[model samples]
Target: MTLSFELTQSVAILGGGPGGYEAALAAAQLGAEVTLVERAGVGGSAVITDVVPSKSLIATADAAVAIAEAGDLGVQLFAKGAHGKPLKPEIAINLAAVNKRLLTLARQQSDDMRAALVEAGVRIITGHGRLDSDNAVVVSTGPGGTDFDRVEADTLVVSVGASPRQLPSAMPDGERILTWTQLYDMTALPEHLIVVGSGVTGAEFAGAYMNLGATVTLVSSRERVLPGEDPDAATVLEKVFTRGGMTVLSKSRAEKVERSGDGVVVTLTDGRTVEGSHCLMAVGSTPNTRGIGLEEAGVQMDASGHIRVNRVARTSVPNIYAAGDCTTFVPLASVASMQGRTAVFHALGDVVIPLDRRRITANIFTAPEIATVGWQEKDVAEAHINGIVHKLPLAANPRAKMMGVRDGFVKLIARQGSGTVIGGVIVAPRASELIYPIAIAVERRLTVDQVSRVFAVYPSLSGSITDAARAMHHVERADED
Candidate 1:
């Protein structure tokens, strides 16, 4: 079927993140003229600062860990020494070189995004855009600076994105106290790193830095790490981190951060102080909703400054819609892209699939990556169906043993009565890549028996997944008997 829309209406998408760009592409494909206005580069925070850079840094850290563990697999290294005696192997990392490569890759991604949008016939405008009214947007050539141009559109998409939330007492100076966005500017590695929060971002940075040869201390206000993730996954991560020489301070909330000589001191709410050569505040992100003309234009926002929108991405005001991190929806690149597409679909009167929060999969990129889908363990415990949890340790897998992987497991949660897979958690090397089959299983409501029938490679790490499914099947059968 040919999908077409009335060309009379035009759309102006503000902010060029995954949401904005994807929405622009969708709109253009549906025959609506689109103009994308962005203050930063095309890929927004996901590319220019946060996700791309941090993941690239994590990749380097993963490589370092792999090298360090190579010796266990009988790999030996030698260096030239006096009299041909055995020499200690040295691994050197150039921070500047890593940053250069990271920025190069990020820029390439941004360029590709721009090229794709252009090819889709969307006009790209480099500026900070704000809605003047329901159907008009004023674009400023610079952020918080004057030179403005107003563009009129029949449909408005607000994908203004978000910024790093900063506490007044712990303001980031881009030096001693830093945000994740500022880490790319460093030419040298930190001697000691203190990461505040213990959330996904903090845990990820702490793990990455520790792997990269830095002494890391993770401070969390909660009783355990990763309060937002599955308890089992969090417990495994905490154990792995402590075993890897990371000092974790749970139930400790940072009250203030102050510069001390060349380093910084983070004072806890309990009056205890922790000092480190560098501190990264990974508390959370704030929506970029301030000064965006939302109130004047009758667009509604929630208490947390996120724009209020329905499943279709429609704002309180008709003809105005919001998507991405700026909206009340969960902040993820995948969710943002879907929200964008949904907004365009609803706006153009096309077949629209409302946003499904349940099916979205999220990953935390630590040494042993954590990936989850569908209902969480906490939710399953409180639900109607009795849940069975099966965990298969990677240590028992032949491929994991061969690869020298000691810390990780594949966990599957299934409904006790129906045997339908409800959720899955993978904690292992390349867990991100290994999570697709589980995600598909959960999405399709596949039974444990069905999942177990799929043949995984013998002696492969992925075999653990199938093994976990089989274990779940055994538990279900026992329960039935």
Candidate 2:
């Protein structure tokens, strides 16, 4: 179907984050005039504060872990002493320098994304933007909030994103008390970081800071660190955290966090108190969908204010679409990008594939990253899917053993009778990369037997995936018999 116009169709996107940027680019490529208005620079919180900087920081932490593990791999460092007796080299992290490097990298990425958007012929407006109606956006730009730029368009996409949820009892002062975004400001590694909440964000930071040589106390209200993830993955990570000297306080909840002299004190609901130099509130985030004129424009939203969007990223209003954390879909950068592209395609009469939760890839950037896609073992147990599971420990992998890696595993889940790949979990160094093939299998609905036949790099960590698939070959054989 063609746009009902002799002239080029116009599209306006508010908030130039991953979703907005992708939407603008996609719409522009489809022969539409696109205007992208952003409060911050391009790339939004994902690049500027959240994902990029945090992952870079985790990379530094991983480097620290590598140096410590190097000794186990027969790689040793020695320092000359006064008595001529060699002393083991101390691992020290120059946190200020690391923070500076990561911030610079984040800025560079943001700049690159902005450059790409400009090169794509998308008009860029730097300002705070809000929907004026279903067909128009109003931006507050220039000095002292005194100027305004209004854009009217044929299609509208909202990707305003979300912010770290703050509680009244524990506010982020950007110093002693911190949010995930405020962590890069520290000049020194936290002496003792009390991380509240045991979800992905909390577990990641707790593990990362501990690896970086900080005394970390992880406060979890749940029974495990990653309550929502695979239990086996969480068990392995919790073990690693304990082995690395991190204090995992499961079943604990922080009632309040207050400044105590130069440090902070956290009070628990059970009348317990924990003291630390800094506290990171990783409770979760709230969507930035409030007061955005979405309701005024007849856009439907949930009680929590997340914009409701269909699988194709379309809102209740036919011409309006929403994506990213602000929407009711999965809050992931990759998912956001896909939703953006899909939204534009659906809007402009192009082919579009609705998003599937099972195809989404999620990873926790801890020491040994946990990556997952598709159906999980929990789903089978909960009767959500009829599937079988096979698990192979990384320790049994030739490369993992050779590299002195002692933790993590590859778990694959497949349909009971058909053996069709459904979901998987990978817990290993750079599991994010390793989980891609499994994702492909799930997306293609390839059976375990088919995946087992694929030649994985011999003596590699990924070999465990093939091995696990091979071990589950009996499923296919049983059906054949």
Candidate 3:
């Protein structure tokens, strides 16, 4: 297919993920002709497989958890076919329907994003796009990716996100051995699911399947699950996992995985073995930087294959930018969108505001979800950022008491000298939503006193957040006195 380049200023964005598509919309809004090239649909892995699918399944699992505790609150759950007769409560999950719903929700979200971009007058080309010489993008088209199209642009934005990193010894067959992306495709709940690499992804899935009534064995190479998260929160999660019939093996690294008599065995590096009906590897992700012509185009990248970009998302090559997981930065959907927008603004000659890494919030979507923003306790202890920390238990909140929540807390970090809200962490249900106010406080440089003054609903989980801030405010006052 032959198509002429737009005479007006055009931005060609590769990868229709959060970073790429968001940049396309922003550039289109900025009066630049934007064209987005993507092999997959819009919204990328966040909507397609990683974020949306996993979280949607987590919702189902969380509902099961809540229902399991309904009897304590005088709510009786009857079997659907019991005809009003009380029988033993059962949480029977339809794996086929669940997987179908997960995939449907993901594609629907991708469709919604695509419709928005189309409405914004962005031309979307379906293909694997790569940087070519002479300020152009070569899109590999047709059924077999042989036919191609050379598209012209004034500037280029590369936002192709990363993929699940595979191990040579333990290869995922997308059936017995699976990656996080293929987990939702299973037709049946694994009888004994063995999860390796207990990072955010592994912990979330392991907790979710356990809630869904699966026998789970969590293999953590580290001393505890979610090693990157807060120690207190990780401790709480590990406790919950162990209490919920999950067998957690700490400091055990899976060296090889093989099929053994219709089951999977994960042999540890220490010569130990874990056997299960299925296995999932949540090791990490590798950036999709190869064959994108990034290096040939003179774009700088770190040794680990992530593109090296500045605060404004500029690469080593002039007029070319890299954003999202493709760059060596925090892998958050929100952060990726901001990086994409920042790149588009700088490229389109608009006012450029560099991304603030400190103000970003990250959340792990396991039960009793953990969310954090701004300076961490380690950062303060290391003198990287000075902050006073105050923690309040969720059990102290009236709403938490009503909801029977007992295993979570809120921690607020305020600047030592100014008492300005610097960072905070929340370990509770919907902590993702809870972190927003803390993020706003940090972003606006609001003080602990100011945050505490903001009226939180009485007896609510938000009250715990405010209480933590109040505790810090009191400490600041006492220190000043």
Evaluate all candidate structures by whole-model CA lDDT and list the values in order. 0.88, 0.93, 0.89
In the range 198-299, model 2's lDDT, one tens digit per residue, is: 999999899889999999999999999999999999999999999999999989889999999999999999999999999999999999988889999999
Best by lDDT: 2
Tens-digit lDDT track for model 3 on 53-103? 999999999998998988888888666555666577677899889999989
State which candidate, 1 or 2, has the greater lDDT: 2
In model 2, state the lDDT of residue 105.
99
TM-score to native of every candidate shown = 0.95, 0.97, 0.96
RMSD of 3: 3.5
Model 3 clash pairs are none
Q: Which ten-residue region of model 2 has the weakest summed lDDT?
A: 472-481
Arranged by lDDT with the best first, the candidates are 2, 3, 1
Candidate 2, residue 177: CA error in Å? 0.7
RMSDs, each prediction? 2.3, 1.8, 3.5
- Candidate 1 regions off by >4 Å? 142-145, 474-481
Best by TM-score: 2
